[model samples]
Target: MSSNIQIHDIVITEQLSDRSYRNRNADLEKQAFQQLAKQSSYGAQAILNALCDLTLSLCDADSSGVSLLQVVDGEDGFTWNAMAGSMASYVGGRAPRHHSPCGYCLERGAAQLYSYPERFFEWMRLVGKPIVEGMVIPLYGKDKNAIGTIWMISHRDGHQFDRYDLQIISIFANHASAALRMQELY
Candidate 1:
């Protein structure tokens, strides 16, 4: 474990409003599905990349990516599998599992909302983009264990995400889970 890491037990996952999200755009959802279906043939990586792009467009996020839990340097960590928007250059980056927002999302077993995550995650500072608000949805594999997370970030401070944004990301997370499971099989 890196000695410089800090574990901030901040509970960023709030009880988001349970009210049915009314702002969903049916045409956009349909388009995202179509895009994902088309990418499936290109393999999991393609599907993940398409998912990131779709997330950026659908949620109007400054950056979006998938973080998959895996062993890195003999320790458990999360790898940025795919990315889009401003953070796309970090597609292959890695961070310790226990110290990241994705780990907290997996632990809560729900979508998490982070405000100024770099304050808690020191590694995020290295990305060079300050995350104002971020949303993370847990991704599960075939055994139903959390295998990773899908996250979106708003670099603009005061950019708030409502239930509609949460719903959209949750839907995409479901697709991401299926893609990961298929990836496990192959």
Candidate 2:
């Protein structure tokens, strides 16, 4: 634990709306999917990068990134495989699978909105700047296995997310999943 870290013992959630908020942003939802469709011509890395970008825009988030699960020496964890916006400095970083939000999303196998994510994993507080709100969607591999999670976070107050944003992020995650399986840009 870093001495510079602080815990408020409080959670902040302001803009979280009802699950039916999807109906409010119908046109924006369609625009997001259509833009993602046009991103198909690019390679895996490019696609992931674009997906991150789309996540930031579509979700109206301060930051967005994909954390891919990785195993080293049999110790399982996640790596910030790709990122965009505010938290981008943590790109290529590692987080424990047991207490990480991305890990929780993967385990749940569903999209989730996390309020004040740092409370779940204190290490997230060790990063440069913590995100107050996060929406994460699981990413799948060719075998239909969960490989990672694509998430968007907002560092600013009064900028929370809803189900519609989750759906939009899911669209890009699905595209990244299939594209990653089909192409190996490594």
Candidate 2 to truth, TM: 0.81
Residue-by-residue lDDT tens digits, candidate 1, 78-142: 98999999999888999788878998888878888877777777778888878888888888887
lDDT of 1: 0.82
Off by over 4 Å in 2: 1-39, 184-186
List TM-scores for all candidates, in order. Answer: 0.88, 0.81
lDDT tens digits, residue span 54-161, model 2: 887777788888888899779899888889998888899888887777777777677777777776567788876767788878999966788888988889886768
* Highest lDDT against the true fold, candidate: 1
Q: Quickly count the clashes in candidate 1.
A: 0
State the weakest 10-residue window (summed lDDT) of model 2: 5-14
